[model samples]
Target: MMTSDNERARLLPSAALDVLGNDLLLRCASYLDADGLVQLGRTSARFGIPQAGQERSLANEAARQRFRQSATEDERSRLPKYDGESDVGLPVSLTEGIDLEADWERNINPMFVTSSYKSAVAEQLRSQRTAKWGESNVHCCTYGCKDGRCDWTDWDNETGSFDWQGQEELEVSGTIGLLLDLDEGTLSVFKNGLCLGAMKEGLGGEYCWFVNVGSLCTIGISRGRAPN
Candidate 1:
């Protein structure tokens, strides 16, 4: 017998697909995987090859184009003006600030507690970090750590320490805040407001920060000496 969480997890993608229909669902599911449907897609008998076919049908050109045209107008009305520039100077650290916390606490927090999509992404990030760095203390590595190793220390919950080196004072932009402190040599990432997860340099100086908030995940790095 499937648990309620399992059943709901399996049904979520399907229900989302049902409401968004096949086309939008496919786009949404593209960011997701089979395990993204909770364990239901894997263990439940209700989901199978047919659902996969339905997902593919939504990916077809006709469906995609139709959704795109309809969605464009709908999205325009719903989405606020972005002004075509980064809102870095904005007073709030992220989209989830103190003002938005009340609504998020009531609505979004519950979903994160129960949603399989959140769990899947979190697990994927955890695995990726473990595989890449082994048991080392995860740091931003924004400076010229060419070999991908740093002398930073991890944070200790019990005994706090001032672990900052001269490198920490180097003012770099595009980094929202520290997610995981390197003083304690643990893999825990703090997702509090203004605090983000570990960021590592990707191909071509691109930086990726693992954020549960979705919007704060990708951060572009700019290299330069600290401003005097």
Candidate 2:
């Protein structure tokens, strides 16, 4: 008697994920960055792998890893989905109201270097940018600044215009991540998984998510993370 794929799946180990037991698989998954784990979960689901419990476990563990050191139990309990929609402390502007289901779905790039964010990089960059440009003219709303000016690129001498570009558009090679410090009401940029600096406006007193969509110059919160 031949077994159906579903039956075989039930009777045997997972198809590409075989060598790993559920707990072991989950443990390995715990090491993945939030985005990586999410992508893996999605891929697993699409392949008919039932990892609901394991995925939840991975997420819980990741959340703990993110907040275990600094957050109180209460704050940990209050952590919302990194999905960018649950900032309870702020007004919901049109940008914040936009659906971010697709934006947060970025695949974990192969180049990412996993590391806990440090405030020093962010502060240093902010100070440098400020020294060079005076103050950040970026106007971030509940979502974030979309005018492409937030992440300033090259300044054109002929047009006297600044070229705004997302991290991916830069000539340098690096990975970008969003660092949200809910306890501090701060949102900072992370480059290659390190803090670049805090964004000046449209943050604080509320949790906000940021992203750069469409063009190199486009910067806005699609209602999620990885603020540009």
Candidate 3:
């Protein structure tokens, strides 16, 4: 029986040809790695139709990967660490003096606040309407020591970062002051002056949001008088 690698090599040529015929020899080249492209170039040369050079093949693959993995605007801003001290302070309390009843009424009733600050919050809530799920893929987080230093501490400490997958439900209100960014087909939410979570597009055009919360409880997005 043919091994998996052999099967792949045998099948890849036909697949590549079907996708990229005489019209565009570089079309299917983006899917191939260095060695695969080299083999493909050899096959093409055998047929006297060699098209892509080594540099062009490598650059195309790199470009495709970059396009696939590029982060959204919101994601770029909400990184794990900041370069300098931020003007914004952490949330005094997740839930302390928040008028849950009033906030709920405002959230559900769609009542407009007259105060400038309250209007700003309401505008933010309106902005949340644009938040949508982004690309989804298997993300692996490795926590281990490297270069004789503790690289795993970020995932080991109590307040350290952790990896998550799937739709994340968040309990946020106007009083909580959460920020959401939806750009480059990705969604990143920030709360309490920290990185709350991120979402990316997945298979079948579905998006998954992953959040690492302190406690394991059901979380959902609330905006525009509806819970997301």
Candidate 4:
């Protein structure tokens, strides 16, 4: 058979990718996280346009992937998914509603949850309990410490890294809020939806949410937007 010039042209990289199309790219994206998907979109036109709707689709997929991992199958199925059609912020596990109660481990103090990735240090957690929280891959925000004021700190044991020291003299009498903006790499604290301000900036890598519950028997955590 004679080699066709048209066939050779069609077999070129771009043409081959175009033939595979967005569906193929999306299938490849399923293996990737949101960040990977965004990067893929930037690669070529065949991967799909980086438009709002397409971005939302990628985000919805990512949110579902991020959500309810530490939860039981029954709990995950029952968990509400964030409807970006109604919500203003990006769809996330928090926005989709996470049962933090189910995500906790009871200890001497009260309870502490595992990392977002659910990789907890069993021995350390067993020893220190909630005492040396910042020693692990955990992010900490204290409301009332020994100094009788709020403090912010986080750490990564693997890399020996830590930063974010924001002290606020909050009068503990109302609902407290903590928000982690992974995109901008900032953490903000609030009081009853009132934005206190960005406590930390330029945060990097993965971090788990944590708190040192001394005398408090009950801790309530809910997710939504804090007015900017």
For residues 1-228, write the lDDT of model 4, one tens digit per residue: 877998788678676565665455545565765455556545655343345555544333443444434445644543444333311122233344444556454333544543333345444444554532223343544445323354443322332222335444444545667777666777777766677666666655444565555455555656555676
RMSD of 2: 16.9
Residues 74-177 of candidate 1: C-alpha lDDT, one tens digit per residue = 34343222333221112111122333334444334433321133456445544544333444343233322222122322222111122222223222323433
Give the alpha-carbon lDDT of every model. Answer: 0.33, 0.41, 0.35, 0.49
- Count of steric clashes across candidates, in order: 9, 3, 11, 0
Question: Any runs in candidate 2 off by more than 4 Å, and if so which?
Answer: 1-16, 46-228
Q: Model 2 compared with the native: what TM-score?
A: 0.26
Which whole-number lDDT from 0 to 100 does residue 4 have in model 3?
100
Root-mean-square deviation per candidate:
15.7, 16.9, 21.2, 14.4
* lDDT value, residue 40 of candidate 2: 58
Give the higher-lDDT candidate: 2 or 3. 2
Candidate 1 Cα misplacement greater than 4 A, ranges: 1-36, 39-43, 46-99, 102-133, 137-160, 166-176, 179-228
Q: Which candidate number would show the highest TM-score if scored against the true structure?
A: 4
Candidate with the greatest lDDT versus the true structure? 4
lDDT of 4 at 13: 66
lDDT minimum window of 10 residues, candidate 2: 152-161
- Return the candidate ranking by lDDT, descending: 4, 2, 3, 1
After superposition on all CA atoms, how large is the RMSD of candidate 1? 15.7
Assess the local accuracy of residue 144 in candidate 1 as a C-alpha lDDT between 0 and 100. Answer: 25
What TM-score number comes out for model 3? 0.20
Give me the overall lDDT of model 4: 0.49
- Model 3 clash count equals 11
